[model samples]
Target: MHTTHHCKARQSQRGISLKMVNYVLTHGALENDKIVLGKKEAMQRLADLEREKRLLMKIADKGGVVVVADGEALITTYNCSHRN
Candidate 1:
């Protein structure tokens, strides 16, 4: 029973991590040195992306223009070319 519970916990943790990864991948953008988000707008955008599985790119375009960060979210500009 204990072993089963432990395995289940691990599975759940993994799922959570994957979801976070997906969220970041679908939202985060790299500019210059740091990976950051648009702060206020990112929360809503993240929700929309998670529900629909489609990113709303009104802020930043994906591919050569913008690159996603690895872990944790931060605040930054929408334009990849722009620097702080």
Candidate 2:
């Protein structure tokens, strides 16, 4: 049981790390091997992260795929039907 719990915790940490990497790669500016964001932009990004997280949680509760857009300051969600 202890080993199973540890494995689950490790998987959760990996997921979080992946999310951070994705966010950085999409939005962060890489300068001299360092990821950087401007003061105002950083604050705005934090707000956007919270908003996106809440949205993702709601969607996950309904068993929906998590969809995210580019890291621009604008937050937009599209509702379109897929045609098979």
Candidate 3:
């Protein structure tokens, strides 16, 4: 007998870049396809959760929103229990 694994896919669309999806998920913004967003919404969605606010971007271009950490762009990926 062979065992098959049941994998749960995250994003509704496969075209959504893994980096982009992971970005939103990690920041406590998006919840399973919903995002409580923030500013720069004109081209992207973001949220200042501490400030209790959200901004929605009207554009649909999948531009890479650079997130800087410790004076550098955080470009990375690793093997975790989850991924996009």
Candidate 4:
């Protein structure tokens, strides 16, 4: 899949803000359903809650978020302080 240069530029010029990066990483699965963000905004959009949960847990497992994926799961990515 192609990467969005918009994100790349944002991270390069200004360090990825914790809030915005968190949103991108979570795939719109915010805690308490309070963090307002468009569902369509996620890079790793899952079909439903179960899939989303699994995805988020997988992300939380690998040290916050790092762009990595395989055939078994969709390409999910995240950045705590930007993964160089």
Best by lDDT: 2
Q: What lDDT does each candidate get?
A: 0.57, 0.67, 0.41, 0.64
- Cα lDDT of model 2 by residue, 5-35, tens digit: 6646786877745555456667888899777
Output the worst ten-in-a-row residue range by lDDT, candidate 1. 55-64
Error of 3 at 7 (Å): 8.5
Best-performing candidate as measured by TM-score: 2
- The alpha-carbon deviation from the true structure for residue 72 of candidate 2, after best TM-score superposition, in angstroms, is 24
Q: Summarize candidate 1's per-residue lDDT along 1-84 as a digit string, tens digits.
A: 133666468868777454554555566787786445566668778687686654445344543145455567644434464644
Inter-residue clash pairs, candidate 2: none
Question: Ranking by TM-score, best first?
Answer: 2, 1, 4, 3
**Candidate 2 minimal-lDDT segment of 10 residues:** 75-84
| Clash counts for all predictions | 0, 0, 7, 1
Local lDDT at 22 for model 1: 56
- Can you give the lDDT of residue 2 in candidate 2? 35
Q: Which stretches of candidate 3 lie over 4 Å from their true place?
A: 1-14, 28-33, 36-84
Candidate 4 lDDT, 36-75, residue by residue in tens? 4565744234456669788888777765765567977868
In candidate 1 the C-alpha lDDT for residue 72 amounts to: 70
Per-residue lDDT tens digits for candidate 3, residues 1-84, read 232232114343356455654565565455676764444652343234423332223111323233345556566533233324
* Per-model C-alpha RMSD: 15.1, 12.5, 16.3, 15.6
Greater TM-score among 2 and 4 belongs to 2
Cα deviation of 29, candidate 3, in Å? 2.5
